[model samples]
Target chain A: MVKPIIEVFDLTAAYGDFVLLDKVTFDVRRGEVFVILGGSGCGKSTLMKHLIGLLRPAAGRILIDGGDINNASGQERADLLKKFGVMYQSGALFGSLTLEENVMLPMEEFTKLPPEARRLVARMKLSLVGLERFSGHFPSEVSGGMQKRAAIARAMALDPEVLFLDEPSAGLDPVTSAGLDELILRLNKNLGVTFVIVSHELASIYAVADRVIMLDQTKKGILAEGAPGELRDHDSNPFVHAFFHRETAEVAG
Target chain B: MDFNQKTGCLKLGARLDAGEVSALWSAVGGRVRHVDASPLETCDGAGLALIWYVQKGGATVTGLRPEIAALLRPFDHLPVDPADAPPRDNSLFGQLGRAASQIWNDTRDQVAFIGEFTVTALRCAVSPGQVRWGDMWVIAQRAGVDALIVAGMVSLLTGMIMAFQSSVPLKQFGVDIFVVNLVALAILRELGPIMTAVVLAGRSGSAFAAEIGTMKVNEEIDALVTMGIEPMRFLVVPRVLAGFLVTPVLTVYANFLGVAGGFFVMMALGFPFMALWNQLVSAVGVTDVMTGTIKSFVFGILVAGVGCLRGLQTGTGASAVGVSTTRAVVSGIFLIVLVDAVFAAIFYTIQW
Candidate 1:
C-alpha cells in the first residue's frame, strides 16, 4: 500500500468549552485530491485550520509526511509547514503590497534566492495562475477572481508537496469558479501535488474530488467517506444521500 | 566477528521496529558507518527511516538479511539535502536601522499629510459651504462641550495648587495680597493654555485617533475613497475646525475658573474679594490673555493634526488600532510640548 502523506489519528478539535470535531481519524494518500465536505458551521474550516497547524487540536495528533506536526516545536513545525501550501478563503493577500511582491514574500522568507531570481520565480508563479498582467496591481485593485488567482500563485511560490485550500470557490460566480476548478485540475495533473480542500459546492466537489469525507454539525463527526459518486449512489445514510444529490427534504429537516 | 571495531558496523537487534529505536540508538551511539543485520528479526518504515538517517553520510551496510533489505528497499532512494539556513538580521544594529528608517518614513508621511490637510482647510475656508455644518456642530459638541468638565476641574485644581504654593512665601513677607497677581499672570500667560492643550490631547485627540482607526480597520475609509469624497474634507476638516474654534474658548474658560480657584485660596488667606479682584484685573493684561489664547489655538491645530494623521496611518489588524491610538496620544503630547517650547523661545526673544 502507498503510504499516506497526511495522517489524522483520533483528532478532536475544540474551542474552550465547545467541541467542534470529535475523534476524527483520516488519511490523505499521496497524489490524491481529498475534499472535506460539510454543511455550514460543521467545523470544516476548523478542521482545515487544525490540519494546517494554524490551530492545535484539542486531542490526538496530526502527522504530516512522516513528522508529528502537533508534537513539533516552532522551528520543526515551520519546516513541516514548508511541505504544504495553503490558500485561505479571503485570499489573505497583503493589501499594501502588489501581487508580484505578495508572491515573492514566501520565497524571500524561505529561500536564499537572489533578488532577480526571486522576481523571476514570482512572475513565473503568477503566470502559472494566469495573473501575469495583474502582477503590478494591488489586491484591492483587482477583481475577486484575479485576487483568488493571485493568492493561489502566492501559495504555490515554494512548490510545496501538498496544497490545502479553504473554500476556493466561495464568493465566486459559476463561470469564474469553473475556471478555478479547471486550474486546480491542471495544476494537480502537471505538478502531482496532493490536495486537501474544504468545500461545500457540489459541482466543484464532484468535478475535482477523488474522495470526500462528509462532516455533520449535529452529529459532530464524519457521516460518510468515499468517492463522491459512490457516496451519492450507494451510501444508505439519508443525510449523505441528500447532501450529494442536492435534495432539500432530509437535509432541511 | 564482534561489531564494535573494524569500521563501526552496527549489529541490529532482534526487533528493529519503531518501538525499539530509543534503546537501540543509546546502545549504538547514533553514528553507524555500516550495518550488520544478521541478527535482525523485524523492521518497518520507521526503522528503515532511522537507519537511513544514521547512515545518511555515505555509510555502507553489510550482512543485511534479505527480508530486512526488502523492508528498507522502498525508502532506499530518499532524497538527502542540506539543512536550511535561518532568517537574517536580528542583531541590534539591524533593529536600530529598521526603527530609524520607520521614523523617517513616518515624518515624511506626516509632512505630506499636513500639506494635504492645509490645502483642504484653505479650500473649505474660501468656499464655506464645502464644510459640513452639521458634522462640524456635532464634533464641536463632542470635542468642546463634552470636554468642559474634565478641563475645568483640572485647570481649577491647578490654579488652587499654584495659589496655595505661592501663599506661604508671600504671607511670610506680609505680601499675601500679591498671590492673586502671581496666579492671574501665570495662569493666563502659560499654564492655562499648556494645561488645556495636554487635557485636549488626552481626551479628544486620542478619541479622534481611535474613531478613525476603527474606521480604517472596518474598511469604511476605503468605502469613502471609492465614493469619490475626499476623506480629509468629509471626515478630518470638521474635527480640525472644531478644535480651532473650541480650544481657545476652553482655554479662556479654564483661565477664569483657575483665577476663581486662586480667589478661593486668597480669601481663605484673609485677603478681601475686592482687593483680590482689583489685583487680578490690574495684573492680567490684554497681551497676556492674547498670548495664552493664540498659543492655545496653535496647540489645537497640533492636537487635531497629529490625531488625524496617526489615525489615517493605521495599518490592518486589531493590534494596529491600538498602536495607532498610542502613537496619537504620544505624538500629540510630544508636539504640544515642543510647540510650546518654540513659542516660549519666540515670545522671549520678542519680549511679548
Candidate 2:
C-alpha cells in the first residue's frame, strides 16, 4: 500500500471553550481526490485550517508529507504552505490584482523567475483552468465560476504537489458545479497532484471523490471515511446513511 | 431550477451591474437600489467600500471638497490611449483643458476620500455616551504617564546639556547667575510643549491611525454601519476628546522635565547652587506654565482628530494602511502648527 502523504491523529480544536473539531483522524493518499464531506459548520473547514497550519489542533498532530506542520517553525511552515495551493471559500483573491497577477502571486513570492517568465508561467496556469482569455480581467470583472477557476489557476501556479480547495462550487449552478467537479478529477488524474476538497455537495462528492471522509457533526467530526459507494451501501450511522442516500442520483442511463 | 439549461444566466449580469444600492430597499418609498458591482463579476468591493468609508470618516477637509464629485462626469468613461499621442494637440487651450480636467479628476478622488473618511469616522464614533468619561480618563492617564516618563528621561539629558552649554557661556560672561533663569523659562514655556507634542504626534498619533485603520480594513466599520450605528460617536469623538483633555496635563509634565533639564545643566556649570535655585525660581510664573499647558491641550486635540480622521478614511485592505498612517502624522503636525499659530495670535492680541 502507498504511504499516506497526509496524516492527522487524535485531532481536536476549539475557539476558547467552543469546540470546533474533536478527535478527527485521517490520512490522504498522494495524488488522489480526497473529499472532506460535511455540512456548513461541521468542522470540515476547521480541519482544513488545521491542515494548513492556520489553526493549531488542541490535542493532536497533523503530519503533512511526513512533517508535523503544527510544530514547524514560521519559515518552515510558510515553506510547507507554499507547497500547497489553497482556493479559499471566497477565493480570497486580492482585489488590486488582476486574474493573471493573482495567479502569479505565489510564484512571484516563492520563485526566482524574472518578470516576463513569471507572466508566461501565470498565463500557462490560467490556460490550464481555461482562463487565459481572462488574464488581465480583475476578479470583479469575471463570473463566479471564472473567479473560482482563476483561483484554481492561482493555486496551481506554484505547481504545488498538494491542492486544498475549500468548497470550490459553493455558489455555482449545478452544471457549473459539475464542470468544476470534472475539472478537479481531471487535474488529479492528469497532473499527479493530491487534492483535499471540503464540500457537502453530494453530487460533486459521488462524481469525483475517490475516498470520502464524513464529519458526523453530532458525534464529533469525520465520522466515516471510505469509498462513497461503500459508505452509501454499508454505513449504519443515520447521518451517514441520509447523507450518501441522496436518492442514489437516478442513473437515467 | 435548471436556469442555466434555459439561458445560462439570462444576462442578469447587466441587471446586477446596473443595480444600485438604494434599489435593495425598494419595498417602501424608495427608488431603485444601487447594489455595488458584484464581487464575482469584479472585485470592485474595495472601491465601493472606499466610497462608504470616506463618507463615514467625515472627509470634511480643505482639499477635494465634496463638490468635486460632480465636476468629473467624464472620469468614469476613461478613454484608452495607445503608444503615440496625436502630435498637434498641444495647443494652449488643450493644455488648459487637460490641466482643468486633471484637477477635476483629483477633486473627484478627494471627494471619494472625504466619503471614505466620514464613513469610517461615523463607524468609530458610535455610542459616544457609553464610554465618554472612560475615554477621557484613559487619554488623560496616557498623556500624563507618557509625558512624565518622557520628561524625566529628557530632563536628565537636557539638564546635562544645559549644564555643559551654559557652563562655557557663564564662564565666558563671568555672570553665571543667569544660566538657571535661562534654562527654566526656555524649557518651561517654549521648548517643553513643542517637543512633547512632536513626540506624541509620532508615537500616539501613528498608533491611533494604525489601530483604527486596521479596524477599517477588517470590516469592523462595516459591521458598525450595518448595526445602524454611527462610528464617529463611538471612535472619533472619544479619541478627539481624549487628546484635548490629555494635552494640557502632558504639557505641564513636559515643562517640569525641561526645567529640570536646564537645572541639571546649571548645577554642572560651576554656578553657586543657591544662586542657581533663586534664578530658576524667579523666572517661572504660574502664567507661563499655564499657557504652555493650554498649548499642549490644543496640540493633543489636533493630533487625535487628525489621526482618527485619517484612520477612518483608510481603505478596506492592508495596502491603504501605510497611506493612512502617513496622512495621520502629516495632518496631525500640520493642524498642531496651524492651531499653535492661531493661539499665538490670540495670546498676543490679548496681551494686556
Best by DockQ: 1
Tell me, by lDDT, which candidate is best: 1
Q: What is the C-alpha lDDT of each candidate?
A: 0.83, 0.69
Q: What is the C-alpha lDDT profile of model 1 across B1-352, one tens digit per residue? A: 2347556777777766434553454455445678776777665323554566666656677667776665445334433431122335879998998999999999899889989999999999899999998998998898889989999998899889989999999889988788888899889988999888888888888888989999998899999999999889988999888889889999999998998899998888787899987887888778888899999999998898788888999987556778888998899889988988998898899888
Write one digit per residue (lDDT tens) for candidate 2, span B199-233: 77877788788888998988888898889866766
Q: How much DockQ does model 1 earn? A: 0.07
What DockQ do you compute for every candidate structure? 0.07, 0.04
* Model 2's TM-score against the true structure: 0.68
Clashes of each: 0, 58
